[model samples]
Target: MGHDRIDPEGIADPVDDLYSQVVVSSGEKTIHVAGTTARDSDGLVVGETYAEQIEQTLTNVEASLAAAGADPADVVRQTIYALDCDAFVEEAYPHVVDFYGDDALPASALIGADSLADPDYLLELEVTAVLEE
Candidate 1:
């Protein structure tokens, strides 16, 4: 398995490694996680605030990664869907940075959306990863 993160010289660096400019990876297996939200084990929405929901969402993503025999470092791409993009960046981004850390940051996109599958859901995460078989 191999994974290489790249930030070309011309492109300005992302603040605090929030994401990579490009991610090149190869492995025996690939994991594609569906959009995950801040729902708990009993199918209840987890948090009231954006930060709290983001934290729980990340936890769900972590669990999905583990179930696929992968980890944060194995993640190559991530798509974040938020009801409020600005709030996500301002209030909830810290939790994301803490979850992935600087070294394991993946190529990511944060998208603003008006609604989700559930009314209470504030954010959703979709992840793609690679791992050795």
Candidate 2:
């Protein structure tokens, strides 16, 4: 849990409540999670809308972090991919902030992908977290 989120003094702060300009993690254990899509335990794609897909995908990310003994607040970096990138940024991005609350949002990237592993898949998430000793 030893980390610092920087917005930098000179740069225009990011408008989305999604990420920081930089994240510095000073911890012994780091967890690298693979990109995860909005698939349920049955391996079925969940949600048809962008918001639902993003929510389920973030929920999956949270589960991955918990299994690794890390919390969302410990996340140092996050990369999100969406098949409908424009809609994701414009409509669905704000929903994630509700999950993370208002502190230490991870340094993030939102990418547009032509497709995911499944045609029904709309969003995927990957994160790196530093576990507090």
Best by TM-score: 1
CA lDDT of each prediction against the hidden true structure: 0.90, 0.83
Candidate 1 segments whose C-alpha is farther than 4 A from its true place: none
Backbone clashes for every candidate come to: 0, 0
Query: What are the per-residue Cα lDDT tens digits for candidate 2 across 65-124?
Result: 899888788888889888877899876788777766668688888888998888898888
* Candidate 2 lDDT trough over 10 residues, lowest sum: 95-104
Error of 2 at 3 (Å): 1.8
* Model 1 per-residue lDDT at 69: 89
Every model's TM-score: 0.94, 0.92
Model 1 local distance difference test score: 0.90
